[model samples]
Target: MTRAPATRELRAEPVGSLSVWQGAALYVGAVLGTGVIALPALACRAAGPASLLAWLGLVLLSVPLAATFAALGARYPDGGGVSTYVRHAFGARAAAVVGWCFYFAVPAGAPAAGTFAGAYVATALGGGRRTVLGTAAVLLILVAVANGFGLRVSGRAQLALAVLLVTLLLTAVVTALPHARLRNLHPFAPHGWSAIGSAAMLLVWSFAGWEAITHLAADFRRPARDLPRATAMAVTVVGVLYLAVAATGVLVLGPADGTSDAPLAELLALGVGGTVHVPAAAAALLLTLGTMNAYFAGAARLGAALGRDGALPAWLDRGGGVGEVPRRSLAVVTGLSGLALAATAVTGVGPQPLVLLTTGSFVTVYALGTAAALRLLPRGGLPHRCAFLALVAVAALLVMTGWYLLWPLVITASALGYLRRRQRRDPGRGVITS
Candidate 1:
């Protein structure tokens, strides 16, 4: 033989390098977050003890909602996730707008998650706006850096965080259960049955991340087999934990629960005596960081996929290098988060707009996803039946969100207008970044 070239052993891509248990852990991390910390108080304010019913109702709704996304993930299995499904079911224009809504929502939502944790941290170390702001900034930077390495690193970290969070939550529930008074539940529906709907709107944020988890379906060793199983496991875990915390807020904290932002801290202090501020603050931070990391990781992958697919400007697509991190996408995410945080800190504006925008964007995504499932999934089957129910439920939830829908509407219109202008000038340009 004169001269021969040696073949390179290609490095395997590390996208879907996850087991079922790891997948379940990641789901738990993403789904159980800041909502567990502060939203209970808001729910309690809206429906008193009846907020427990709101929690249960959303969990029940999650059954079909989770199934809808899991089926789509198993069948489609793409990094674009809900956006890819929307593209398949609707068209590119709609998909682009929806994708933009989702990508941008992280910037808005991450700050809210940060503030939930930051408030507790500030209180623990003696309250100050500067402490809250600094704590949140540190949280954002830490999560972004953790995810910048790769999915495997993020997934393992998430699993550990989820375990720690579950342990803390369970400890709180057990410690407080003995102090729970049955009489606290007597005036359950003080706000009336209509209040249940209001509470459900507030509580919807808590039940969000199941759709987000579908982005990582491709990372599972056997996506179709494990995705549904993982989802079911996650739902059970999240539901039990959420119900336990809400019960503690109502039964143990009673009237004070509705007003306290740090309901879990209050419950623990009541049960143990003395300020358990440090432990409470640490728990809140861990809970928020876990959730933030999950979203940052998923959105980074999604942004790269969108860039590669021409849905977004190709300049943003830099994560797919055999076995590398989504650095470009993460930089974009961190930048947006930084700006949003700065604005909020300077303007003294509340995070309600950002929260509403995130909720509305995701709700739109849910509606479209369930609609796609109903259309594409095999008819006369259980999956199809669940999709049908989910579609109806998502539509009703959208209406319940009311004027909040306007935020996503404006975003969609702006996105469409930009795409149209770009197309008019370029004629055949699409968004592939190579």
Candidate 2:
């Protein structure tokens, strides 16, 4: 086996049993989360029709960002993904911080995904916060159960779910386009052109899962060949879908798009001249499930990798294998996610803050990963220039995150502190490679 040089060999799991389409589905499922449902509305609210510019910009930005991570995953093809990249490019301590940030962030995201679906359900039904919170908790638990069966089972399910979600979303977008009015394009920047930055900040969260799916790239049947193709496929699909839906939301609903809770449903309703709540609700559930399932599955594997490295408890490393389920890690992730749901319920904090928190953590991880790509990719080349520009874009997005950046910062500090203590005590556990 060819080993990753100059560092401890990163564990490569037997993940390549999956097909190219499955790999594409993994990327799609990991990324097209519940954010797709409401993010268009939020962006429209922030930047009027000009939010379409934000959408276009992100789609363009995602090309480089997704390509950067795909190159890393193709090169490394390890369960550690970006964590391994950071470990090789920076050091063990930095990798641990990235790992900690990612592991903890998934729990927060679970609730966000659940709440997103629950909110749609609540709107259709007659429930409120409790209903949303309860639904979210149930969804998280269900995802845990589904992932307990392992990746082969979950990955196929995700493929079906992704197909379902994209079909439903595409149906709404295409059907509603005929009703989209040109007049809505006027007064496009009501909030001012600068508001595109704020809108981009909100939408950045939706673009976060590119790195998350890298954790699963090693599972692709042909990681080097299929991984980049899958990334490209997903990027194209997502960009078109996001742009279409966002544009439809603005055109069909006009100013109402921003305030409407269920813009996708609203677009369908406008097109068909009646409410499409049932199908919309079902689509929302699938979208939520796809996201929750992907993250839970990816995080479980990542947790086991962290455990094996002593970044987390060793017990998590036991009972793990490629394609085989990581039960202990699944339990830990599920338990933390349940706790996050409870915290949301108890504190009456809505999903927005949790979304922001998780997004902030992911942004931090992406920044580190992109920086690593800058170092790893050949110098003074197209790939290097792309990584450098991606680094700058991600840095700008992190700055836009503002106080939400606090969560990842605290996690990084805590991780660094822990590693410092461990290194001091052991004196020779593992060397931090540059």
Candidate 3:
């Protein structure tokens, strides 16, 4: 008698909640936040016109990396995205460390987003410390309130804001093209290729959140097949948008002209020749608000995942019964973020420090995740070889980029401390990988 074909095991029960579009929106909103608006100027400062090339390099590197995560999420569908994947491949303690590192990274992002929002508001209102801090506080509270309601509510708001911001950004880019000068292209690599690589470290951070959606894999209607596509689509759209805006910035304002505090706004002011500060400022305000909203939603989910995995206190894992909010987790996220914002404001350190710290942590996670994928590949299959090669490439980029390897030891030590505490508290508990 012929034997029946072997059945594949399902790792986790499907939550069966979020629609495809909702999933897509979450991916897009998470990736496009404050970084999209801020990076063009920052990259311009670092690499001049050659930053566009860096953006392109990041897009190429990120897509496969995102696909690798999506594949892991589809197979696992666990609470913590990268944490879950690492646990499955490496073991529970390893996963806990990953969770802790990600948890640490998530809160720092708050100050980055808040500061970006505050800066835009400062420009709009003619600048003041109190005004900037107050505006940031108000924006954070608004996003926190919305998140405390439900993911569906926050996701819808994200969709709307993302659409509006993209529309305005595209309009500005297209409108300014006619006024672009050719002289800007004369000295394309003013800072040399090394600057492009360094800036790529920062540029990759802007594109980092595409994998954030993987944390909610259980919510996807058909995660096994659709998650990868959604992730690829989100990364593609955001990458194209970033390139378009960066190209426009370089073309219109030239790399040198747009390197100031409010680069995009400055570019619009110059391009429009003193006739459009109001509209440009208004767009900047909206873009900043959108960024804050996206980060708030994405970061909270990450924290909640960490809590659910027992990397944090269990109280944060309690969802507000059906249709209600994750009030406890929301509080933790908001409180930590608020503390970071206050520290940033008092120390007068701009977003760069936090950006570097968080980005470093994230790249560590990315390198670890890719390494985990290589280990998890089957013994003999064409797909396995392909994945192994991809992971190798990812490893090279992580090394060549060289930011995470430089400063991740501190972050790793902190994560190890957290992991030890968790393990000591419950030695018998098998760390849930999914």
Which candidate comes out best when scored by TM-score?
2
Flag clash pairs in model 3: none
Instruction: Give the CA lDDT, 0 to 100, for residue 256 in model 3.
Output: 56
The lDDT per prediction is 0.81, 0.82, 0.68
Q: Clashes in model 1: which pairs?
A: 16-219, 310-431
Candidate 1 stretches greater than 4 Å from native: 1-15, 321-323, 431-434
lDDT of 2: 0.82
* Superior candidate under TM-score, 1 versus 2: 2
Query: Candidate 2, residue 141: CA error in Å?
Result: 1.3
- Per-residue alpha-carbon lDDT of candidate 1 for residues 35-136, written as tens digits (9 for 90 to 100): 998899988988899989989888888888888888888776767777777676666776677677778888888888888898899889966778888888
Prediction 2 TM-score vs. true: 0.94
TM-score of each: 0.93, 0.94, 0.88
Q: How accurate locally is residue 156 in candidate 3, as Cα lDDT from 0 to 100?
A: 73
lDDT string, candidate 3, 309-388, tens digits: 66667676776222335577768778887888888788988777677777777777777787676666454644345456
